[model samples]
Each structure stands twice: as C-alpha cells, then as structure tokens.
Target: MEIYALFGTSGTGKSSSALELAYRMNIDAIIDDGILIYEGRKIAGTSAKYEKTKIQAVKRAIFHYEEHASEVKRILDQIQPSRILILGTSKRMIERIVEALQLSSPAEYIPIESIKPKQEIEAAQYVRQTMGKHVIPIPRVEVEKDFLQRLIASAQQIFSSKKEMIGETTVVHPPFTGGRIQIHPQVLRKIVLATCNDFAEVGQVLKTVFTFDDLPRLYVTLSLKLPYGRDIPTLMQDIQLALHKETSFCLNIAPASIDIQIAGLELITTE
Candidate 1:
C-alpha cells in the first residue's frame, strides 16, 4: 500500500486535509501521529499517550496490543502491499512517520491551513466537492461474524463458573435476600444492545462503523450516513466521545456485566 503522511498542529485541520487528499488520491489508510487512523477507527500501537503518568492505562493498552500483535499482523498481511495510505500527525512526529514510511527523500509536508477550506463554514462544500461515495472513509467489514458470538460465549462460561449468591450468602456485609442471584443472560443481551445502539448512532454521525474484532485495538468503521439539516462536525465530535467510551468496555464476568463486542455495523442505506 502507498503510505502518505500528514503533519500539523492539534487544531490545524490535519484530519480534514488528509480526508480530502484521501478522497482525491484514493488513500486506503491514515496514520495520525503515532496512531493509525482509518475510516472510523484509530489505533495506537506502542505509542505514548497524553498523560504519561497513567501507567496502568498505558500498560493495559500495550498488553492488549502485544498479545494481539500477531493476529493484527496476520490480518494486515492479507492487504495488498501497494495500497495507498495517508496519515495525519502532529508536526513533531514527522520524523517517526518518515522512518515508518521509509521515505528515501524528504517527505511531502503539506501545511494543513493551506489545504483547509477558508473557514469551518466551507466544510460541507469541501467534503462534497472532494470525496465520492466509492472513496468514502469506511472500514472493510472483516470483523468476522463469529468473533462477538465467541466473546459472548466465553463471557457466559466465565460467569456460569462463578459462585452464585444463594441462601443468604454473606461476606463482611449484609446477607443477600434473593434465592437465585445468578447473572442473567438477558443482562448480557441488554448490554450488547445498548452498545450497538450507540454504535449505530455514532456510525451515522461519523460516517463510519466498526466490527467488534477490531475493537480495543482500532476504533474502525465508516460513516454511511450524513446528516441533512444538523451540524456535521458537532455530530462527529459526539460520536468520537461515544467511541472512546465504547472502546474501553471491559466485561466483569463475576457480576456478568459482559462488555458488548462491537462487531461490524449494519449500514443504513437507501437502497
């Protein structure tokens, strides 16, 4: 795959310019700073976060990536080598991008402001003028339908194997009143459904949806729908927030609060 890099400040509109270029040039993947930003997904493998002091969070992200690196590589290896990739990054990380892309010469450094529309008011016009439907930023649905089902099954097994609160079983506190305090399967379904609902709404807003297997590693997907009358960027921001929350879901099997695996999205199409 052809890998391209974009660099600028935090609010200099790096993403928009990259998306625009991606539309024009048919770029397949985007790297933002050290994070790989594709469609609705963003992944940071071995990248440091804003709060370096959050050691536990850092460890968690790294552990997951380390454990799954082979699986990720396996999936990535399936993609053709000549695919064009465009990445967005802060100007500070240009060196890293250079090394990663293995550029033989000075990399193409396009200033975000130069390519960005004169004002935020021009975003709609810019997006319409640039991106085509076929070239829209969206994840390839390869989450594998069975992944979530397997995750849920694993969660069920974990929960079932745990001890139930029966016969007024007490710890250091008051005794339980209910005879059967087992985790209900319905609760799992509800968690999954609620998470999916968030996914749907977020997908429509961001113009991206992610399959669950890509979860925790990369928040990936494509926005299939664009709002007609509402503010697009605002809607996108909201979806981004929801995406952050959904990606952090870790199921507590003892209480049977299974984290809903975000599989692929059900695209909203007029056809």
Candidate 2:
C-alpha cells in the first residue's frame, strides 16, 4: 500500500485537492490530515472545532487523531490491497505524527502556510475598485418568501414591496466586494513548495518510466521571495539526503547544479 498525503495550511485547498487527486488516482481511501476520509463517506471523530485555546485545541486534535488512526489502519489492512494515505499538516506536526505512528516507510509530507487574509482582501478590493463598477446580486431564497407570507397572514410583521433609491448603486456581490488578489502568506508558501513537489514528481516519473541506471539529466527551477533563512537551504539538503537514504534502486538521486537564489527576506524567525 502507498500513502500520498495532501498537505497544506488552513484554507490551502487541501480537502478539495485531496478529493480531486484521490478520484483521479483512484486511490482506495484518503487519510486526510490524519483523518480517514473515504470516498463519499463520513467517519467518526472527524468534527470541525474552533477552539479558543491553542494548547487545548492541540490536545483535542491529538485525541481525535488517536481515535481514528487504528480504525484507518485496520481498514487499510483488509480492503483496497493498495492504499494511499494523504495527510495535511505542517512539517513539525508531521514529524511528531510519524514518530508516534512508528511508520518505517517514507510517507509523503507536505508543508502548508499562509501570509494573511487582510492583505489578500485589500489587494483584491484594490483591483476591483480600480477595474470598473460592478455588483453581484444574491437571489432571495424561497424560504424567506414563504416566511414573509406566513408572517403577513399572522400579522407578526408587516410586509410591503417598497423600493426607494437612497443613493447610487453598483454591480457586484457584497461578499465578493474585495475584488480578488493572491497575497496570502500560506499561498506564497504553497507556491514555493509546489516547485519542490514538482521536482520530486519529475524524479518519480523518470525513475519509474526510465528505470535505468544512466538516466538523462533533469533540472528543476524554483523561485521565492522570502527573508534569507538558513532553513531554506537546510530543508533542501534534508530532502536530498532523505531521498538518497531511502531509495535503493537503479535511478541515482543527486542534486542538480543550478541557481537557488533567494529574492528577499521578509522576516527571520529562529527555532
């Protein structure tokens, strides 16, 4: 069985992408972010909670994972001779989860992040304001109409069709008022990591399809504008080392000679 984890940060499209990829790949089931989410089915202990305390939230989250992990493992054993598990988690969470699970094999790990929603909304709104005048309408629901009629019949609230122009109008949905922009920190991180995944994917294809010792050289290029952190290079080194130690096959894994330039540093956080 093979596990493919769809990892990303909050609202990073992990759930949506996981479902799509699982359908495309026809994987038996998906262990989404440590939760066993099967196709068109719901499992227990997978509830969305907006806890206030971070520590409490973390503890509750761990409990939920433990509750479902064994069941997921059992399901993997009996059905779907070949299984792919996709987990959505940060790098730190992934390390802890893998260690706790004692997984001997390489399980795909993806790191998700986001910058800030305010910045994204501001950018989107700016574009919309500069572009043109537009407004999106939200259709009134039938239930509201029915409730209005009932209220009129019972004399609870008076109903009348009154239309008086108070001021100028525009075309666009209120919810979509903030035009549209791509400036989420998490999105930025996703873009950066997507390049890494692309490289890994290409290497995977080459190793599988070619399956030869002397393979054609391939190069992967990636760019990121972030504060210069030693972690970036260290992370690259870790990935290369992991690949070298894990794979024992015909294909040789080596770092290509290319440019790994850091555009700019935004912030520097130490661990």
Candidate 3:
C-alpha cells in the first residue's frame, strides 16, 4: 500500500488538516489517533483522545494496545486501500504507528508547517493550550455508532466539509490533556517591548498598546536611529517579523495585526 504521512507537534492542527490533505491527494483512507476512518466513516480502532491520562493517551496514539492494532490492521487488510494518509504528532510517532500496524514505510512525509500557515498553526495551538480544544476530523453519524456515545451533537463545534466532502470536523478536548490555561495580559505586553528593544535600528519605543477584544492587535510607536540612506520599509518589516515570532513563542498566540508607526528618525552619517 502507498502511504503518506502528515506530522506536526501536538496541538499544531494536524488533525484539522488531515481530511483536506487526504481529499486533495485522493487518498482512499485515513489513519489518525489510532482510528481507521474510511469513506467519511470510522471503521475500527479506538481513539487516543478518550484515554484518561497522558501516558495512556500516548500509548493509544502509537497503537500500543495489541487489540487496537489488530482491529485496525484487520479492516485495512479487508478494504485494501490503494493510498492512505497517516497523521501523527511527529515522524517518530508515525514510524511507531507504522511499525505496530506492520505497514510499509511511508513514501512521503508532509509536515503541518507546509500544510498550515504560521498564523493558523499558532492560533490552533493557542486554542489547544489555553482552552483545551482539539479538532477531530470525523463526520457526524448516528450517536449509537460513536465510540464516545456520551458526547452529544450540541456539545461539538462541527464544520461542513468541502465540495469533495472528505468528512465533517468537530472541536473537542481530549480527556488526557483537558483544562484551561490562563496567561496574563502584562506578560504579552512585556514580550512586545523586549522584542522591539532588541533591534539596533530602533532608538526608542515611544508607545506600545495591545488590544485583546477578539484576536490580539498590537500598536507600536518608535523613534529610529538609522544611517542616512537606510531603507525604512525593510527595517520596519524586520521588527514586525520579530514581534510575531517572539509573541507566538512566549504565549502561543500571535497578534492578528501589528501596526508600527515611526515617530522620529535620527539619521547618522554613512561615513
């Protein structure tokens, strides 16, 4: 069987992107989180998300349970899909899943970074880290058939599929890592100030403001000290890049927009 792998860090939107990738590649089936989803329906295997602890969840995700591996392998053998996409948190994890299922090595590996935009990946990680929400790519079916019969339709946030309609998707909080994470606003502000001061071109940061009604937005006013002929646009672009990268690193959330205004410029001799 031809196999393709999609890998990313936990909460980096791998599951959210799985159905689309599968549909785009014309894959016949998907193996994710220890479940066999075929033709927009789950065929066999237990989801690791339902595990009660982190260790148990890791075991389930890697198909550590003999019965779970056997169940999925049996169905895959019966269906004999020509092309399949396997989603995992990392290449090592995918390797483990492949080994446990006795499947051939993957012919291709697609990283989540290639599939999702930097901002989108950061947003997904923010939701997962702060609110404990996870995107599960499974179409809605009769509740009786669901492995977690307890989760009602009302509790899930579902999105309709594309025209090709690989499968519907819902946001869920996996039991193994479910909880709320709180980050102080002051911490976010400090991150911005520090990143700005790191630039040698910046003379002084006159003002900094952060708005957090929906997505975070940053407004920065600065005085710059540059050589007589320094390129202004390129310098500002560099600072913007640092702000996004640093803020995302510290808080797992990047501002939707950053507005930087130049208040003053002290041009020095290029000589």
Q: What lDDT score goes with residue 68 in model 3?
A: 88
Predicted candidate 3 versus true structure: per-residue lDDT over 29-131, tens digit per residue: 9888878888767888877777789899889989999998999999999999999899998899999999999999999999999978887776777677777
Choose 2 or 3, whichever is better by TM-score: 3
TM-score of each: 0.32, 0.35, 0.73
Candidate 2 residue spans exceeding 4 A from truth: 48-54, 60-68, 101-104, 107-271
lDDT of 1 by residue, 201-257 (tens): 444322232222311122333343433454645644564555445533533111111
User: Which whole-number lDDT from 0 to 100 does residue 131 have in model 1?
Assistant: 24
- State model 3's lDDT: 0.80
Candidates ranked by lDDT: 3, 2, 1
TM-score of 2: 0.35
Instruction: Write down the lDDT of every candidate, Cα atoms only.
Output: 0.36, 0.37, 0.80
Off by over 4 Å in 1: 33-75, 81-83, 86-92, 98-107, 121-271
